[model samples]
Target: MPVYKAPVEDTMFVLYDVLKMESYGNLPGFSDAPRDLVEAVVSEGAKFCEEVIQPLNVVGDEIGCKRNEDGSVTTPPGFKDAYKQYCEGGWLSLAFDPAYGGQGLPVTVNAIVGEFLSSANLAWGMYPGLTQGAMAALHVHANDEIKSLYLPKMATGQWTGTMNLTEPHCGTDLGMLRTKAVPNGDGSYRISGQKIFISAGEHDMSDNIIHLVLARIEGAPQGTKGISLFVVPKFIPGADGEAGKRNPVSCGKIEEKMGIHGNATCVMNYDEATGWLVGQENKGLNAMFVMMNEARMSVGIQGLSQSEVAYQNAVAYAKDRIQGRSLSGPKSPEKQADPIIVHPDVRRTLMSIRAINEAGRALVLWTALQADVSHRSEDAAERQKAEDHMGLMTPIVKGVLTDLGFDNAVKAQQMYGGHGYISEWGMSQFVRDARITMIYEGANGIQALDLVGRKLGAHGGRAVMAFFNEVGTFCAQSKDDAALAPFVGSLSKGLKDLQAATMWFMQNALAKPDNAGAGSTPYMHLFGLVAMGFMWGRMAKAAQDKLAEGADERMTAKLATARFFFEQLMPESSVYLARVTAGADSMMALPAEAF
Candidate 1:
């Protein structure tokens, strides 16, 4: 009843033409990678997701995940086999280093591959995607012996990984966390904590589930500074690398949720589990962020994936379903009515989704490029700038794109009219699944607070300023490029609007502390919109330059997409600018007792 086709052309355009990611091929660690390999991998990956993984979408959501009384969780009817297929196809380690049985692909290409995989079946796709994040964290923080023990199998996908940070009483505020760990003198700790909302927590899809958990050590500091990370497995591995004995890890229950029914969200109980410290003692929270950043970016891909699937379904429905007369008179008199696509509002909705998705895709891909630069650049200053850009852009990737992705989903459902609300159309699933994105991975509101309260003040806001200056320099270099004028003009306006909103928020937050919280979400989104618009404009500039030197029709399609983005999506900033500049009075006027 539903269909999705990977936007392979668009993906190629973003990877090769827009970001020009292969430019990094000259960098020391990345010298082995170039455009041809990038193209070959993404193309093959897209086809694999389309033919193998996507066929499982409906099956996954319908079958969901079931919990057994014996502390184990069963994945959707065929998830075990599907994930096995995924792992066997070498997808699990596409971006990992080659030393651990991975392909050592550039992360930029991996991001595109992730987008396609998720678009096909996000519910099932989340399993490996989240595991990749866990693997990355442990790889960064785990000691050599522990890494040798777990990383190889997890990277190869014989085993999987899960994150355990949230508990029943705590969601975003880790400061109130009650998870505890006690030292066991022989270079290990015993971890005991109840973690809620653990995705892929205790599933039977892998030989074992490796859990990277957060808990406070004995006599640790009272707040966030005391939190430490531990590696706790479901079953202890014997000398033969098999899970021989059941560990003290078990699932209390699986959450019954609105969407992502295919993926298990568990309430986990860790009872004095044997644990190994991944990083420095009492500095675990800082170490775990290695995984958190990766998780947050993957969540951003989920947002885009959700948007792409919803857009595809809605577009198909609009083209085929004919119930209304044309507004410009009778365009379909032979049939009794016209297709919904003939209507202006329907056109607007579809265009909005298309534009946001395309712009959002560009922003996401560019960030991935920066992420590669942060890790692989040869020069120290270049690496520092890349790291700064990655830090500043991470929240936007998580906060703004996801927010728009959900909006696109809602518009998609609206496009289907009442049919969208009914489960069979499958439109509702997009909205429901996308909702969790806003709440988790540090709620978008919190991301804004970090942007203004922390990142903005980081390095004296010079990181963000460098970002703005780069955008300005790009515009200056491209003003003479004829085909890019419209996108550049719109982007220039959006940038000014964002700059104004930033100045207003800075003044307000200084004058009144409450102003920061009240303006947080709006400010975050405003920044996100302007940031994406900047990317879109750069895309137009690149496409225009290529055209001046001579490109084919495919390049024209990009120009058209750039035009559509400027005309439609950039206007969103006006709305957020007002909300951001609204001051604290509007939000704080209501007393706590009024409710």
Candidate 2:
């Protein structure tokens, strides 16, 4: 069986030392999340994930979700009980508003806990993850009555939520969607549509499911401009705000997916479901973007979560599996053969995964902190900058992390040799689960295009420029420190590569749009490299400071991993830069039907 231990200590280090989260105590939620309280919450969360949720991972995958004749779905065994425990423990309410029965902690805390939940059991994690995304959207876009009716129950996990956007014909192209909503005589509307690939769409765990569906109002303009969002619950609430009547929305079928079998990825059919419009009549895309962005971030963490669990299992196997003797001579003379970990190639692979996982954790936390700042900060300039950071980093995080995450899972699986391909070892599940992250939440390709085609130039390039300046400033400040020289120097070079790629896009993309399209993936990856490189530099500085105060093996290991990242992984930035500047001539040279 695969084992997953949440990196709680590393998470704390990133929170308290690297990100300096407590320093923002003046922020609304930060003051409530003192070091001790945060530690306790995360530690308890970690314990629950390890002891309760992780053991069911293989079970969930084996049984998957089942759809009944009544059009209701049941999650894998133990999931319902585990989910109940999760809600009762107040995990879902950690970062929500106190007014809505939440703990009112920093969003960062919730994100950290989310990583643990994902690593433990991704299929189970999706149950609450989608709900969190829904709450975020409703909190931001839904009217007061809607929020009052839904947010509190959703906050406490008494209700779960799902986003309904992709139809049978539309995935990324919302303009092509044909779902229609007709105005009801009173305040609500009648929604009729079919949405596919809806995670946690229908399940027995929650009292009711709140689905945020995107549909066009009757007589509305054509295409995406006419689209609007609606809140369609599985059971409509009565005046007392309790589930009273069953809505017309029902699960058509659960998708037999590549992985995450425990999650009910349903084909939902709505037969004139009673719904209320969220936000404006024709501004559905804008309103849904809130949930989509939230989901995208969570999906990015799913990538990291799978990679982390896979790495942990691979490392355990490496230490125990005996193979040929070490090249450096007999390290274990008494044994018939040395452990596979003695091999240089194996060490290299492990180091590579470790390096990225550490830096990736830092990157996630840092970005999450930006989310908190954007939401909570009182200053307009600070809020704008934070929002810019989120807009700029979202695509990179979603694209690059998932791309690398799948790659790392494959690498870790390779450590098991032939056994890796087998189901019993559990590595296959990680590989399979990690695969969806790259494809879902606006596939990695779309994420890249969003970065290049929209986000890079958004607000007259303010976000990208700010990112460059912040990285450059970090490099400049750390240049003189010999301890951080390597990381800072590598980060500086990576930043230059990213900057050059941006310039290339600006210069060439307008003349040939295909150039931007072709280069966007590499540019997103290049940006991720620099962002992670920046993380390594900051982490290295923190490690050095800790070492200066006292001796610590953990700090030593951190420095080594940061060095590995700088020496080995950071060099990939140049390759992506090369790809970014290669232009689209050759890529687009092939004509239609040439293949």
Candidate 3:
């Protein structure tokens, strides 16, 4: 069984002490939500996750979901009621708007809550996880009429939401999707196509399912510009805002994925499905990106959440399992054998995983904060800067978190030696579940290219400069904090390496377009690792300050984890930089005929 003790104390400290979330209340609509309210919400949410959903992790893994020939999907037993608890508790709408029945909590609060839910059961958690994306799309692109119709049920969890983007032949290449939509006599369109890998596409937990789909109109152009987004429901809504007549949409089949078995992955075959356009025709691709961004960040959090859970379970196992004597001394000779944590190599593995997990958590929270500022800030310059920061941070959130998250799971599994390979220990499940995070919501390789090829050059290089300036400012401010000297020094050098990589790309992008594609992925990781290291440095400083103030013992424990991160985690930059600087020669040299 995967044991998970909610890290609520650390979560509260990070939100209140490190980020000072109370200041967010002054940012317009949040005047009513105080620190007490936020803390209460977090506490209750944590408790619910630890109790209700955490037990389902292995149950869902072992039992998985069943897909019958009738095209209906079944989640693990008890998932429906557990999902009902989530709905009744109002988790789906925690951070959404109030007019739509949401509680309108801070996004940062949602981040912490989501980490708990996802860590408890990534597969079962994905049902609501995906609904949030569809809800986000409706939130962003749905008109007043559509929003009034759909947002409430989704908010109340009466209806679940899903984004149907992938097709039979297309994965990340949205431009090649063959889905088609024809205008009906009324305002609606008739959609016909096949969509694959649609998670929570067809589930039994909700009364209705709303699908945010992408399909091309007749005579539309041949690429992404030709694609448009539509709201296609499994059943048409009644005037009273409930499920009525059956819509034309149906689940053709469910995918046999290697993991996330409790979440249905559907092969949806739409035959003249009644649909409503979200934005303008042919401009749907751009509009859908709003949901994609929200989904991307959520998926990244999935990785981080899984890693954190993996660490929790791994730590429990390491303490209880005694295999050999301590190399330094017989510290635990009182027992039958020694704790694995006493082994230097095992400590290094655990510490390295800890360092990355902590940094990843901070980075996600910080990014959420930036997003909050971008949307809620009163000052124009502040809003613009926050938007720029978000643009730079998206790839990092999606790319870095997933990459390191998967690595953390593998490392945690490695700590168990042979048992890690066995499913009974539950460590292998973490590794298996973590794999999908990298592949879905846009593959990590594509994310890397986006960072180097697009985000760095966005706004004519100003975004990149803004990012560097923030790092530079942090370094300058921390000059007096000698404890951060090692981390800051490593961070500063990594910053320069990123800058060099950017300059190299800018200089060669046009003359050598292949260079960008060849070096993009490695360069993305190099930059993401540095960004996580930077965030960890900030977290370490905050923890150390608490120690200086004579705080709780948890503060000292956190400080030690931070110290381990700086010493063990910051050394991988050299290897990534080496691979990136090797450039397009090797990748390009393997010609079309070579295969």
Runs of candidate 2 with Cα error greater than 4 angstroms are none
Model 2 C-alpha lDDT per residue in residues 1-595, reported as the tens digit of each score: 8999999999999888888988999999888778999999999999999999999999999999999999999888899999999999999989888888888898899999999999999999999999999998998898888999999999989999999999998899999999899998898999998999999999999999999999999999999899999999999998999998999999999998999998999999999999999999999999999999999999999999988999999999999999999998998999999999999999999999998888889999999999999999999999999999999889888898899899999999999999999999999999999999999989999999999999988999999998889889989998999878878888888898888899999999999999999998988888888888889889989988989999579999999998888999899999999999999999999998996
Q: List the residue pairs that clash in candidate 1.
A: none
Error of 1 at 23 (Å): 1.4
The per-prediction CA RMSD against the true structure, in angstroms, equals 1.7, 0.9, 1.5
TM-score of each: 0.97, 0.99, 0.97
On TM-score, the candidate that comes out on top is: 2
lDDT of 1 by residue, 1-595 (tens): 6778888878777777777766777764466666677677778888888888887887878888888988788887777887888888888888787777777777877788898988888888889987898889888888888888888999889989988899889888887889899999998888888999998898989988899999999999988998989988888888987777888989899899988888999999989998888888888888789988998888888898899999999999999999879878977899989988999888888887887888888888888888888887778998889889888988888988788788889999998889998988888888988887777778888888888888876888878889789878777776776667767778878888888887887778887978877887887888888887887887776777778788887667777877877887788788888887787886777789996
Off by over 4 Å in 3: none
TM-score of 3: 0.97
In order of TM-score, best first, we have: 2, 3, 1
Which pairs in model 3 have colliding backbones? Answer: none
How far off is model 2, as Cα RMSD? 0.9
Clashes of each: 0, 0, 0
